[model samples]
Target: MVSPVTVVKCEGPKLVPFFKATCVYFVLWLPSSSPSWFSALIKCLPIFCLWVFLLAHGVNFLVSRCGAKRIFAGLIFSALGDAFLIWQEQGYFEYGLLMFAITHILYSSAFGMKPLDLKAGVVMGLISSFLYTLLYAYLSSPFTYLVGVYTALIAFMGWRAIAGVQLCNDLWTWTKLSACIGSLLFIVSDLTLAVNKFCFPVPYSRAIIMATYYAAQMLIALSAVECRDENEYKKKIKVT
Candidate 1:
């Protein structure tokens, strides 16, 4: 088993920059209803930059720790999703959602899950199903079916993130919790996007969506790195 200290070391420094960037970008780019065209584009720039940063970070972690390829692919897809979304009003909304859908699938695969606690998993599934139904009820055609499928994918991704946590000591458990929280934040980000797009616009919804979105991506990226390191450490112990 990987020691708890190693897990902490892997997570500590990486998390600081991720969280710092998330916070700094959110404050600097709070969405304005009356932004000039150039200003709007400038605001959208940070998300792309953050995605690129995380993509590089994930690739480096994989290089050093033998991380799962799916995690790396997820980050790439996320960057593509951000790129597509920056032009969402220019009719790239569907393409953006499609990219994010693929990202969620890759993420779920990397954070592989099993039905460890049947009762808990069942409860989580039921809850997600209910929420999915509620969301689908409000959406209209073209978007209705697409949004329905995306919501279900994200819900399951979140569920699996939680279920994938190993039964280990506290620090190691936190690594899993990071993944779980990240996945849930992703769900929140998309849910807010759906509400802002389909249901009704909340004032300054973009700020909420982007804040959660970047934070989610960063935490998930960090979790992927730490997970890879922990697993490698386990293999080393086994071999020795």
Candidate 2:
């Protein structure tokens, strides 16, 4: 099992230029639905911003560990997924899907197989199975197999993230907590996207998708922060 997390000084994420650029779409400041380079850039700005921030954070502060590097790699793929997905109408859906699958694989690698919690596995499996069952009829040929594989990967990612919690160890650090929550949010965002794309169109689907996706990316990015241990933090508080 991976050791319980220890941090140096946990400073949270700083809002980024790319993240700020994406806000306009969510707020309907630019409501264009057309496919264009500018639109794709805006759609993917959040992930780009997070990647740069993670790199900077890792260099300037804590989280220079293996986990942070894997997370950084995942963000790179995630940004590519966003870019490819914006051109989904022009037939890049599968490529986008592939990129995200790699992203999750890297994320799961970062979380590691700690505590080997069956409870987390079961929960993730049931949810993934339910989603696949719901969309089975709509999936045809290769997409059927592809989506199934993607679901399993995501479930495993979720399982690994949850297992990192180590509730028994009483090591509920910000990194673990944010990573857990971020993984779940990533699942939720993907679930909504899959349902909307294959089953039926969700009203305001783009907004919903981008909102959850950005939030998930943000949290995962912040998970790279390394901070003082709980006792150490408390001790400093007492001193102050």
Candidate 3:
């Protein structure tokens, strides 16, 4: 059996602090009367901390275990995306999107989703088509093409994540569930950002976007802890 000390040591140390920082950022950003510079500082500070936290988790995952390398890599890409997007005013939006695109690709690889069943495939295709049509209607020329490509990647990643949830034998486990939820929330957060940027304004959109994004990242990170190697995990199961 795994000892309590081992569990404590292997688990992420930054989860609590990350959430605390997120809460503080939200409080700072959401209030209408809050100073603009304060809000910007709060936003940038937490993301810097978040990237650091993810890097630490990636190191822990890499040194202590195998089969989690893709997850670690994904976290690194996610951190880069977070850092780039934090400075959207400095013409970093495209760079940020590229980082996130890489992030989604890494995450999709980590999921290791199987070929989709027919119904799931059909549904995902229809959803992707509808989203593309809607987005294209709203976007301008270059962005129409650019965002379309990005959306395709996002849709593929989301499909893979959902497929993992359906096909993984550990569907009932916290790890699988967390990844699935995280994937869904990631999509939601990105869509919100896209709509706010490309379509219309949503009040307190930044708060909504950041909250969902942070939650998604946290869940994805937690999944790494909740799940290790399938072989090792199965061995533990058999021993118990």
Candidate 4:
């Protein structure tokens, strides 16, 4: 017979399988149920918990510790914007857009502060402005307008990143590349959301949009981790 301690050790791996089974059952049962307040609350509970985890652990703790103070603040603002967007009652969308616009600006500033290249900025600005105008013409929503502004900011920052490749003396290329990829994913997710909101009524639209959005957010968090790792590597090199 196995000792009690050995039995407990053997059962540990089973816990994950049991938890996954429970979650699967709960999710499957959720949409078929009656329309009650508690039912709605239960349906949204997982997403609410995810939002809290992203804010508290992913953005606040991880990014703050990674030496990206301004970016962390911007992410907090973006999380607030996400909350406002999810509420979906009243005219909170506009406020959410404003908050997110500020977030994009903060992120742009954080990334672009060192480059100081006016020519690149102007070129990116012109291209982004034209794209924004085209998207606005097609979309005609306040959310689209906000996305336009955010796109322009991203373009500016992206240009800075490209230009600064030569100037990255500390050789944190991987971190920078990860950040660039994360930014691109974020743009793709935003564009997908805009399409979903304004253009076509695709099936499983919410699922697709949320999946992309969450993935983009997670990529951004990974960029923060990359930054932290790069910083530590540089510190180690200096000490050696």
lDDT of 2 by residue, 98-169 (tens): 999999999998887877889879988998899899889999988999999999999899898888787777
Candidate 3 error regions (>4 Å):
1-14, 30-60, 63-67, 167-171, 226-240
For 1-240, candidate 4 gives per-residue lDDT tens digits of 223343233323323433343355365654422344454444344334333433443455545553355556566776666666654345566776777677666656656555466775687678767756756756665556567667776676566544444434554454455455655566666666666655666677656654555455443433443323334444544543
- Compared with the true structure, the alpha-carbon lDDT of candidate 1 equals 0.68
In order, candidate lDDTs are 0.68, 0.78, 0.69, 0.54
How well does candidate 1 score on lDDT at residue 123? 66
Per-residue lDDT of model 1, residues 135-239, tens digit only: 676777888788778877887788778776655433335556778889888888887887787777878788788878877876676566554456775554454
Candidate 2 regions with alpha-carbon error over 4 angstroms: 1-13, 16-19, 28-33, 58-63, 230-240
Superposition TM-score, candidate 4 onto the true structure: 0.58
Ranking by lDDT: 2, 3, 1, 4
lDDT of 2 at 195: 89
Q: What's the residue-level lDDT of 205 in candidate 2? A: 78
**For every model in order, what is the number of clashing pairs?**
0, 2, 0, 0
How far residue 141's Cα lies from its native spot in candidate 4, in Å, is: 7.5
In lDDT terms, which candidate is top?
A: 2
- Candidate 2 lDDT at 127 equals 85
lDDT of 1 at 34: 39
| Model 2 lDDT on a 0 to 1 scale | 0.78
| Cα lDDT for residue 27, candidate 3 | 66
